[model samples]
Target: MTDKQISDIKNRIAVIAAWIVACLFFFPIFWMVLTSFKTELQAISVPPKLFFKPTLENFALIQERTDYTKFAWNSIVTSVGGTGLALIIAIPAAYAMAFNSGRWTKDILMWMLSTKMLPAVGVLMPIYLLSQKFGLLDTKGVLVIIYALINLPIIMLILFNYFREIPKEILEASRMDGTSTFNEITQIVMPLAWGGIASTALLSIVLCWNEAFWSINLTASDAGTLPALVASFSSPEGLFWAKLSAVSTLACAPIVVFGWLCQKQLVQGLTFGAVK
Candidate 1:
């Protein structure tokens, strides 16, 4: 065979391998969605019924008992609110770190990033106690604030990297034209980094939406998110497999849809500074 034929065969094999990996990653979600529509017996069937009659009873049951709308609203509000707050602070920090070099700048960035590696369980107590002491527990404001703070380092890192990719000469020209730092960022940096900013915001929103540990520990009712709603399905009587699956499906659907719709922007943003 010619070299071209060999290359074509290799490419086909790679494509098939990718498809298999993708299916493996997606199978659990597909099973959860499928089981949501099955009867209790069918859901737990030894053979795992992949082809069974679907039912809406699980969805109906959850609707009758839980305030799903409330949970959904909380998730939307907190995720957006947190991401917005994060961006407001992260932009300036990132810009400063990217442009202004200092002896401790790299150390500070690394320290910030290192915080993420610490177990959340280690600091959970202090955070909970402080929130309770300040009467901010179970409040949307607290959740938003905490989410932003928790996600701050990552947001700053992405923005900083994106900003660094911009040509400094452009900023010099803006400065020659008497542009102030604020205007430079607003007019120059922001426009150039728009793709990265958008992708960062989208990722932050998804993280906040999926944060079950914080949501469950911090909020009870009024400000509880969908992850908290999913947790509520568990009882001393053991798990309700069907209804639990149904609620899990509902909780994941919105973000999954959002990610799908914004996939192009996400890809563009992720690859924005990469080429340069």
Candidate 2:
């Protein structure tokens, strides 16, 4: 074969391979969505019925059994509230660490990141006890605080990197212009780094939303979020496969859409420093 023809064939093969890999990764999600539209019998049918008449009965059943809206609202409040709090705290901390690194700054940052490595189970007892002692269990505020604390390390790390990428000269110029320290950050640093902030906020929200262990353990009925709601499906009888799928789909829909809509910003923020 001619060199040009051989190259074209190789490119086509690569494209096909990429598509196959993507399909494999996406299959479970597709299955969940598909099963959400099936009856329990259809969902568990041998060889898994791929082409069945779709139904909204499972969704309706879910709504009848649980207050889907309340769970969804709790999710929205905690995730967004936690993300906002994390950003408020992380921005200032990262700003200081990025621009004015003391000798121990790296060690502090490493220690913070190390917290994420520790299994959640190890600290669950203490956190649960603390929450109960404070009467914060099954409360939205506590979940928000917990989510913010859990995500703080990664959020600060990302903000730190973004802050470092901001030219120091800009802050200097702002100061020369008689801007106060607060003004320098609010007016210059924040605007320059808004993209990174938005991306970080989005990530924090996702992590908070998908946090099942904490949500399930810390909450019972009142403040339980979507993840907790999803876990509640398990009963002594058996897993209602179709209804479970429906609930899972409903819980996942908003975040999936949010991620899809913000994909460009996500890509940009994650790749923020790669070009330079």
Candidate 3:
């Protein structure tokens, strides 16, 4: 075979390999969704029944047992609220870091990134105590604030990278035109970098939406998110696989849909600085 034919064969092999990996990664989610429609006995059967008649009993039980709307609302409030707050803070910080340079700027950025490396459990006690002291436990406001703070570094870093890619000559010309800092960022920088900013915001929102740790640990009945609702399926009686799977499916539906809708932007943002 010619060299071109050999190259084509290699590309086909790579495509097949990628499809296998994708199926493996996606199998658990598919199983969970499928099991949600099975009876409890079928869900836990040793030899799983792949073609059993589907039932909606689990979903009905879940709806009757939990106030799903309340949990969903909490998730929406915390995730969106936190993302908005983080963007508000990160935009200016990234703008400044990108447009201006100082001796310690790189060090400061490294320090900020390092904070994400620390184990969250290590500081859980102090944060929990402080929340209680401030009467912020089981409050939507507290979740919003914590989520914003937790994701701030990542948001700033992403926006900073995108901002750095903007040509410095454009800012110089804007400065020469006597544009104020606000005007430059609002009119010039923002318009030019809108794609990056939008993708960053979407990613931050996704992260906040899927945040299980803080949502489960910090909030109780009044402020419990969908994750908390999923956890509530566990009881002293034992694990109800069917009901649990149904709750899990319901909890994941919104975020899955949101991610699917924004997947193009997500891909673009991830590949932003990868190419010239």
- Candidate 2 local lDDT, 94-158, one digit each (tens): 99998998999889988998998989999999999999999999999989998999999988878
TM-scores, one per candidate = 0.86, 0.92, 0.87
lDDT of 1 by residue, 135-224 (tens): 999999889998898888878777887888899899999899999989999999999988889988888888899998889999998999
Give every collision pair in model 2: none
Error of 2 at 139 (Å): 0.9
TM-score of 2: 0.92
Candidate 1 regions exceeding 4 Å error are 1-17, 45-47, 236-238, 263-276
* lDDT values for all models: 0.87, 0.88, 0.86
lDDT of 1: 0.87
lDDT for position 240 in model 3: 82
Local error of candidate 3 at residue 176 (angstroms)? 4.0
Clashing pairs in 3: none
Best by TM-score: 2
Q: Across residues 191-261, which tens digit of lDDT does each residue of candidate 3 receive?
A: 99888888878887788878888888999989998988777666842378888888899999888988899
